[model samples]
Target: MRRLSFAIATLLAATAMAPLAIARGPDGPAAPSAPVDKIVDEGTNRSEVMRVAQYLTDVIGARLTNSPGMRQAEDWTQAKFREWGLTNVHKEGFEFGRGWSAKNAGVKMIAPRPLTLIAAPLAWTPGTNGPITGQVVLAPMADEAALDQYKGKLKGKIVLLTEPTDITDATDPDFRRYGDADLDKADTFQLQNGGASANRRPSSASRMAFTAKRDAFLKAEGAIAYATMSSRNGKLVHGQNSQFQVGATPPLPGFEIAAEDYRRLTRLAKMGAAPSLELNSEVSYDDSDTKAYNILADIPGTDAKAGYVMAGAHMDSWAMGDGAADNAAGVSMVMEAARIIKASGIKTKRAIRFALWSGEEQGLLGSMAYVENHVASRPVDPALTGTNRYMNWSKAFPIKPGADHSKLAAYFNLDNGSGKIRGIYTQGNTAVVPIFREWLAPFNSMGATKVATGRTGSTDHVFFDAVGIPAFQFIQDPLDYGSNVHHTDVDTFDHLKPDDMRQGAIILATFLVNAANAPEPLPRLPLASEPKASDGFYAAPGAH
Candidate 1:
């Protein structure tokens, strides 16, 4: 009887210390370093990455910013975060233009041969009122200067928008995983001397101006329709256009034809056949909501004063295939990363926010809006309005930081197709190199090792980095994303590598947790100033 009473007392004492055991010294419920093994097991042994990818790509289909598919994606992703018990799960909206969708599209040759061709309608362009039949005209125009040459002769014609270039043989393998040598080469530091600045193409402003002018000219000339040759060598069609703004809706219908088929039409035209074609582009516009949304959810931190760390992937894609490799893969990984972190039951000192950005295909509009609204602000040039404001906003001076500018501890992005996480691009933030090295060490055996100091632009991270925030993109394997997929009709769910996606999610979760618990926020780059011309060259219009 005496021993039994002592055992009951001991049990009561142990039960009283349970709360103390979980407390980790003013940091949070979890240890200072994230539990990497737990993350890996959750990400791998029971992965939901593929399921998420399938739903986003196969079920949701192409997500062109404010399109119906994109709206569905936003709702579905928010539902997922709430299901996972993530806090602050809501969408932030910004002023976007119109949404577009292709109901049905087809192009067929009627005269030379009754052969149907692979084609897709360009986004934000009008559809043919109905089926329009016209003779094909090879009126290749590169700029507005060339538009005058075909001014009055294009009536009742389907104009070939670009000249056919000689198809080149593939030099590198279409599908490739990085070898040790490739990773080593990528590790070399790049100089910021801006060597390629001397050979600049026309600014985006000029290019857009030409696009507006050319579209007006074609419509004024009574052209029935227009088609552009695919830039890719394979018989893939990517329906890409940038006329989504409210006042910038293109007047005439446009389509992108497979390269081989385009070349055949060009050859027939050169041979004096004048291959007659029939086009039917049934599309619609949705102006019900001119605002595109960014999906945001958070795992609340123990210390609100400690800033938040973030992970993001663009949820919007071009209107082509399912947008799997180009972005849905990345989106799945980010979502899975958040799931893994929440499921691991680890509490961080600072919050961890997951963002699924929209309008990324339309010049990183969603992320740029986030930076401008929450993190920092720079005065936009009054002269550079419209799309030019987003394109060249980095050129503006004196960045004005917002209330939460310093509260963003660090941001990591993943958008380079469905390749495995090889490593990370440091984006020239030398101070964070060693910190990333420590966080990435746990996954070294999983093939994520290198930390490159190169700058990769054109993704959602550009605007954040431009504002001196510690933002970065991962280095992924160069799987056919550049060769055949990316913006092509073949960027479907079949191309995503499941193993790579799982590894990427595990790595992303580890980084976010580690950054959240770190004693200090990641170092920031020096605030940007007006850059001097590298070669005394001025590419902007009217610059002397």
Candidate 2:
């Protein structure tokens, strides 16, 4: 994760001015208020949330952007909102290019001994029509020179593009619990030996050079396909790292075989026993450029004149596993919260908007487009009379200036995983920290404590805050999300904690209700000049 800890510290320091004082009557702590009682007793229906989650994950399967599954999810969501009686319930259509779909995939080592190979296709890559058998070739084209060494010899063959790992020891703990510290140690271990002349490996430079060489090799020789081993154990974890630029030539179809399986073939080849593989996969591609869509729904307030409060979660997932915990959990939380509010018949003073966005796997494109089109001021005429007129007209042309600005009381988001809400990130919005404290008081019994004023990034909240909207993402405990579940085959319903999901729903519902009925809209901090970019923390290469 990136370090917004500095921003968090600043928010806490500023918010400390006014300690949140819980409301009290003349007697003492007053009895539970009507709103609080409503939330405590009837809010966060656990069974309903679990039911919806199962339907989306088990029945609908993976909802990759623009896939049939995503379209099905949209229809289900629209129907769900209508069933919940949400006002203005509909899928706001947007132009999206050809959708991609995966049917069946299989890989096997045929020669030297028959054995199944665990593998899966990368997103948007073309697939083999049927079983295609070919001799295996160890062609580590690490650089241009190495690539030239095997220039004319890779045709009609499965190219093994990575070094075969030494499988001498099978019980190394580093292989079992491969965390960040272990990864750093691995790099240092390599550096200790004078394997390479450079003291430190040039990872970025090496990757760029290797990519170019790989692409050239693939095109020069009509290779059958490209295959690499997943660094993890023997599991077909699907993912992609290529930057498929518009004009650049696409590489041969790519797939990741398990490390153990690849090692077996490599060992057999070293022993002079010719190894071969039969690979087959089905993938559909839409070449036309298409823009992804973001689903938005609103619950109009009883007082139609009030401001808006928003909540969101990225609906798209890496075409890997089922995308259960990485995001489906967060999406379910937001949906369930909206359902509870609408079901409880809470006619809030301010409207609440829920957005389940697509193309989040690309680069926050969906949210960025929404903000730019709806919030940012735009020139009316593309052919303007003068620069001054364009600038002058733009200043007064925000469609709904008040509503688009901080008129949003607050925007809450969930994306960490299916964990209980530990607390809320103030996102440097200091003025509203005390108010959140009061709002969170009712849920203390649910283990929702530790409120901090911090700014976290790599999520959709950044899109809102960039344009001066009061936005925040919650802090939840890391529960096997990073290593085991995230973008892995293990991210399924079994990993979800039912208790955690229910707790998060209750907390989020309460927070939104309080924000909706607050005496005034959440206060906004003065905008700061854009900060310079820095080589910060590690983020998933293609995460939205």
Best-matching candidate per lDDT:
1
Query: In model 2, which regions exceed 4 Å deviation?
Result: 1-34, 44-47, 93-96, 141-146, 164-213, 234-236, 241-251, 267-273, 286-289, 377-403, 531-544
Of candidate 1, the 10-residue stretch with the lowest lDDT total is 1-10
TM-score of each: 0.91, 0.76
Candidate number of the best TM-score: 1
lDDT of 1 by residue, 315-380 (tens): 999999999987999999999999999998989999999999988887788999899999998888
All models: lDDT?
A: 0.85, 0.66
TM-score of 1: 0.91
**Local lDDT at 213 for model 1:** 87
Candidate 2 lDDT, 1-544, residue by residue in tens: 2222332233334434534334433356432222654443344322366667777788887877777787788788878877887767765544434567678888899898898888777666677888898988888765666777887898888888878776455453321322344223322211112212222333443564567667666867988887887766646475554333333434666777777888787778678788999988888765464546677788887676787888888887776677788688888888888887777777678899888877666556566556666664333454322122212232223233323674576788889888767677776666666666666665555555555666676787766775567888887766777656777766788877766776676677777776776656777765433222423445697966
RMSD of each: 8.2, 11.3
